[model samples]
Target: MIKLELIVQVHQLKKQGFKVAAIARKCNLSRTTVYEYLEMDFEEACRWVNELRTREKKLDPYKNQILSWLKEHPDLSASQVSDWLEERCSFTNVGDSTVRSYVRELRELYHIPKTISFRSYEALEELPKGKQTQVDFGEKKVRTTKNKWKKLYVIAFVLSHSRYKYAEWQEHPFTTRDVIRSHENAFEYFGGVTEEIVYDQDKLMIVSENGGDIIYTEEFQAYKQQRGFSVYLCRAADPESKGKIENVVKFIKNNFAKNRVFHQIESWNEQCLAWLDRKGNYQVHNTIKKRPIEVFTLEKLHLREVSYPLSFESNHGSSITRTVHKDNIIKYKSNRYSVPLGTYKPHGDNTVYIRIEQEKLIIQKTPEGVTVATHPLSTGVGQLIKNSDHTRDKSKGIKAYMDTVKESFDNSEEIELFLQEIHKRYPRYIRDQLQIIQRSLRDYGPFVEQALDTCINQRLWSANDLHDVSIHLAKLSEKEIPAVLRDIPLTEASSELIKEKASVRELDGYLRILGGA
Candidate 1:
């Protein structure tokens, strides 16, 4: 038989228009059990529970021993009684449920209540106004007006001193950008920001807590840097460290969201804001014994003025995050687009933000919002839309290659200007261009100085042009070019060209060629 309290809750939820399945979910009961409970009235349920309570139990023979044990230890639980029976009683073939039922009946009949030990808490001194704010996230599954359930996510902020509260609700889980947006809204709602904010180690904002050296997510890091606020991340699994926001999260769920009909997320938020003004903030706090709104008046004076206006609808447009796959691709609308090859990492975050604008998909790196790739929005399903430049091997050290090429030529400034032009014109093929210049330095030797002058003066930014110019200069000086130099393929480009190859001619031959030139 279901307990009288559970039966009452089922009837209450049913009256609230909760379906049988929803009621079962809420009460942690099976659907069949809820159906049976709903079929019975409250009077019948009480009678049924009373009849079942008097029924004989498997452990009835040990009633005296069980009562003695309970008299000795008022704090012993049903599970503990079951364990004691298994250890002390021989051939006591009683299941845990039998012992649990018997123990409950005994406790009710004998007036022996289960003793609970409560932890003692000493209240810490209240923080000064504007010193800190605690922030946390909560989610609740609220029943929509249609009787369907929808889960809504919330990020709540509470001033550590004034206990003033601010909250925002969204139908979807928050992204890093969404968290930043909520922070802006909370700051605006509170009239200003606190000097420091406390947070749990939520992955939406924090990447890792590397032995107390906290690393925040990309966009959140940039936001914190821009907002100029200190962050204190509570130790994992320790909710008491930031109890103010924890209470605020629970309050939002129970007092505001519980049994509230969610028609739409926007209206729900509007209702929540109004509720805060009328009830949440205006009511006298139980602990502080002052209205939160009234306390906020003094706290507001101490708060730092908002550094900027709210930009919830900025030109940048809202974005959603997608994880970059091992193939350097992100899925959007059932299609895939590629980021740069090196964008994926095995251990760290591979997430990127995607924003749609003007019929195009803009894929950007996190935090910085730098565009990594862009493609026309695909209307077809399962299509792979990719930028060919993203396929390039970007892991090679382009800076080291540039440095090697620059040091080869005597006119470093001139070579630097030429390489910069190549980078601008052929960023995708920069490694190839640098490799060509390095090869020319090896084959043509000092003649490359004249080639650099030719390429820079004539605006010949192509590596092919540099190679050809160097060949022409080598010929002009009556130096015999090595057979390997003659055989080098100019038009064909490959990554193999970047690898260092042994010189074909001996040291004396290169010296003789340079001496002749």
Candidate 2:
């Protein structure tokens, strides 16, 4: 074996800028042996110099396999082929890396392909606080309960100055609404919006028809107005603006999402968000030389607060009904959305509007400027709606309204009798009229209904879950169902008692239980 003394001398001499010939003279070795020692790793060089050594035993086997693979795919590179072999076969004596070198030499002997040229872009030197953010999406192939290959998109945002990141999963083929909602949610998450949002010309927000004028869809523009931020599209095909987000997507995929197998998109999504909070946010940014939280705390202090009060309502539901629950609460998104307790319910025919503000549910009587009860965010799905059918009369009130909601062949008297019972159970003044309005809900789609069911069953019901579900449905492009559909029972056979206490299964049970109750 080549002695440790010789290896040390060679490295030391090289460090001091000694030529190979000079070092060989001092070491009493031939120039070729000295040069070979320099090129090889210390352990290997020592072994070679001490004795005439045969090649690693597994080298020849790997060489044959590599050549066979390369002959079929001649353009394959060293790293690519090595990775393929590592996964399929295991060699006791040789590392995949040892195989890599043999393949490199074989390619050179045949004068085969070379590494492709890669263009390096110039990077900005001095990014300032809150001035820029990088954004990008990553995707993973998932097999849904339907046994289809579904692609899940995750959007990652990194504030350039702080390296603070936010990530959320989205369905593929981004839509105008998806783009807008994501921005709004991100702003709410960060507690405020930065002045500039750096993005690629994702088709949702960009119009190619007018000289590539970056025209946000009307909804997106309204969202931007609500937050007061500007959108910056990157140069066509250039990814540098959002490089931070791009790198983070890969980092999260490898470190966090890699080991997890998800039954529903929501499960994966919740884990992803939790991972960002626990791991990514707390880790220090390599280039920034400071922790992201440290930078965010400082940057947040400098941002301008909104001058006027803006309503950040969910796309799902804002319309309200006048009926109040016996517990003095109103229901929205599976939780008890409360209105002001002392407010009076008017006797005339009128509608109320329910709005979400800063995570609180607000109910206002329209045109009358009357403020009703307000509730803090709810914790369960069943609390969002009660039996609103009891408020109206059977003979003159809820009897007619029930006819519209029941899907039946009856222009018949029996249907009217059923409506009469519904009206009688829920008096016209409290529950009946509200149930009529609740029965009329048809604005959201099936996927959301399923997602809410998941949330409720898992006991993870929150504004965040509802928000995430709405966004998730919008991405799928399914027809809208009423946001309050869950208030209605999935099957008449299910008892009111069991249905009333229904809990959420988070995302794990969503696929199985998605009958939309």
Off by over 4 Å in 1: 1-31, 34-47, 58-119, 309-313, 322-350, 354-517
Count steric clashes of candidate 2. 45
Score every model by TM-score.
Answer: 0.58, 0.40
lDDT of 1 by residue, 365-420 (tens): 85356788889999998999999878776646788788878887788899889888
Candidate 1 weakest ten by summed lDDT: 309-318
Go through the candidates in order and give the clash count of each.
Answer: 1, 45
TM-score of candidate 1 versus the correct structure, residues matched by position: 0.58
Residue by residue across 1-517, what tens digits does model 2's lDDT show? 3356677788789889998877987788889978766777767766765563454445666666777777777778767776777676654455667666677777877766654668878867857766766777778765566655556767777877788888877553344444555655666666666678887776545544345576665556676677677777888877866788778889887777663565776787788778877788888778877778788898876555544333534432224343344445554554565443333332221234566678766677652366554555665657553333323324443334455544432234433443444445444342434443243234343444454455455654233444466567666654445655667756666666556765656774675587654
Least well predicted 10-residue stretch by lDDT in candidate 2: 342-351
What is the model-wide C-alpha lDDT for candidate 2?
0.61
